[model samples]
Target: MTNTPSNAAREESLDLASIPPLESIPPQLGSPGGSLPAPTVDAGWNTRTKALEVLAILALAYTLFFARAVLLPFTLAVVLALLFRPVVRYLRKRWRVPEYAGAAGALVGTIAMLIVALSLLALPAEDFVRGLPEKLDAASVKLNQEKLFKSFVSMQKKLNGAGDLGVSTETPAPPRREGEDDEEPEGDDPDYAALGAAGPGAAAEVRQAGGVEVEEEDEPATMVVEERPPSLLNRVFSSAPEALGGFALAFVFLYFLLAEGDAILNNTIALLPTMAEKREAVGLTRAAEKGVSRYLMLVSAINAALGVCIGIAMWLVGLPNPVLWGVMAGMLNFIPYVGAFIGAGVVFLVAYLEPDFGLLDAAMAPLCYMCINLLEGNFLTPAVLGKSISLNPLMVLLSLAFWGWIWGPTGAVLAVPLLSMTKIVCDDVESLRPLALLLGPRIEKDDSASDSPDAESEKPAATAAPAVAPAA
Candidate 1:
């Protein structure tokens, strides 16, 4: 057979004589004839490295999800105990109140207050619930009558264009008129009587006006259920037993934490084996517990004051269900931004529903929210929480979202203390020192905005205050 050297000779340097043998390559290539390119420390563009990190993070999250779901209620209780424990301690140490007695008293007081608040919510809620069906009918009619519903009309048009879902596009013929149905009983039906009682001309007019004719058996399928309780109430009552169990668990846990808080902390720390480290850990735990308790107590007072202020404002505006709106604002104020928006939404909805008020009242809802929230954010919280526990807005929002995801509304409400305790723990842990910075607030220094006069002063003329020679 003839060896095919012709194609190899035609290609670029495609010849065995032109290629260096592996053993003849340079030292870098494990030979004498060639060298390898310098290797780079690729820190950024490593796909394998990134994939590993992503997988690890996902695995950790999945593991945490199960752990959190199981222990979320306990975690919630731990945060609350931290918040309320100091009060129990103070009562015990100063007033000589028994720990168990203090816990019982606090628990009863809290529950009684919550029940009274919820009881007050019953009436307005019922009224709102009853009026919903009517409002829905009015709103539906409004879609046909008003230009404001043009947007919905467009949406409906789009929906229709997406192929029929059962509703016929062609105009449906009128149902078999009364008396046309031979199966109908020869008895009085108010609908048939009302439709048939009219004179021939009036009947024609009614038909033209779309009243049409009705069969004796044609009763409305749409039921107006006025007696039904609000879904929120129904849900609450349905879940009451399970909720009570959780509440009872939390209450019991809180009592134990209060009764043996210091002992527990000391014992845990004592197991550390080193006196200095144990002392430090014990001090840190006490500080965190005390701070959390103080914050909760102060927030309660502030929120109550805010609730009263909001209630009075609503009453002045003649808004129905003023108490609900007030309580809503007060309760939500605990969750940073989340509460403020909820309060605003309630006010807006109330104003929208009240026949006496219109768009103007609805607009005032946001303004009212802004004014109250401005006072709370700029004046109230800053003045109250002070520099000691001041979390920046970004950190607060993230904490709220994180804890809310971990638990629920209760988590959102308890986020601050949870995050605060976490921060305290992070501060104590040398390895997690950087994490404390990430979790905490940003410290912005405004040189020009300082309270000092010299910092505020503009640069003087070049002739004045020439640079002084240092130690001439």
Candidate 2:
């Protein structure tokens, strides 16, 4: 027992020596006295990179805003080149056709079609646009002459008591005493007319009170807020020269870009050093070209479907200029969300122009939109596009808005292609690969199905031609 006490005292002294002081010990990361070393952090690169990125983005945004006037067509040309690159490649590789020949075919094809279309439609469109003022004037006149305006006048007539505006206008509403039922007869009603005119007693009491201005609140709230579309006839006529010049330049630029696409891509890529990087870049370029081309083809098919359906729908609806409107709708649909509204506006206006159907057909505008959009979104888009251009919906819409804002309608048309190109480039770079994953179609691994017997079973059997022995 004496030895045990001595041993315990020794252990205690040893513990005290090892522990040193409580303040010296780190907070336990795992167990008491157990802790990890502070982790190494690389904040310098991230901070500098973020600052640089912000600066670059701001600079680019301003540049785009300022240069939008010139850059719009050029940007569109570049996107079109990307989209058509695969077709150029395919013709060269498969048919042994010259690249220039292929590009010329595509460029000519696109321009010829657009020119023909625009020519056919322009006169009617101009006629309609020129007449907008007259149409609106007629509408305003009809509105001013409507019974509703007369009703407002009649209601206002009540406030003046007797013949204030001259003639036997409607009598003023009699004031109701407290606890008087609204259902009571006029003879039994209080004299609110006397209250307004020279009066005493209850009329005098009414004179002591304030007069209320009762507005005729029967008009539709939306009609009250609606504004007329600005007349663009003068602006259209004034800007025609500049517009035509731009159109001419656009055609030339498109042809030049398409014809020189391969050369441009090669020259750019060839400038890179002869290393692994050059090879990787070549692959990425090829992939990006393929992606953009597929998107273009898919969009074209979708547009064709849109044109057909809209034409049929309009024709059935007995609307005038069905074919022209259909073509316009399909062409405009390229502008994303704005396209839908534009198409709807055209349909609504045409419907509203028909005297018998004006209001009735105008009411069908929303329904028409639903049908067309449904056909395009549900049936046409998925079946044709599938997982091809796997763009995030939010990103797609935002990109549409961004490009649209920067370059107007043309910019909106360029938005998706630009976004797809961005995604492709991001996916190619190792540092930005995570963003690619975020932007790319959500891909699923096929490890299980890849090895499954059913997958093999689905493969078609090879047909064997008659075989002769070599000895013969």
Clashes of 2: 0
Assess candidate 2 and give its lDDT. Answer: 0.72
Candidate 2 residue pairs in clash (backbone atoms < 3 Å): none
Candidate 2 weakest ten by summed lDDT:
460-469
Error of 2 at 170 (Å): 27
Off by over 4 Å in 1: 1-64, 67-70, 135-147, 150-238, 427-431, 442-472
TM-score for candidate 1: 0.63
lDDT of 1: 0.72
Q: Model 2: residues >4 Å from true position, as ranges?
A: 1-49, 90-97, 141-230, 427-430, 444-472
Cα lDDT, all candidates: 0.72, 0.72
Instruction: Kindly list the per-residue Cα lDDT of model 1 for residues 1-472, writing each as its tens digit.
Output: 2446765556755566578755343445464554664565777779888899999988876665666534666776687777677778779989999888888877788789878977889998888778877765664554465465677788889988887667757988888876565442223765446656554566567768986555779767997777866687688899789677777777777667767766787778878978888878777776666666777778878888888888778877777777877887888888888788878887876666665555665567667766877797789877877655556578888889877776678778888767777766666677876877787742334632464566446344333446543434
The per-prediction tally of clashing pairs is: 8, 0
Backbone clashes in model 1: 8
What's the TM-score of every candidate structure?
A: 0.63, 0.63
Clashing pairs in 1: 24-33, 25-31, 25-32, 25-33, 26-31, 26-32, 26-33, 26-34
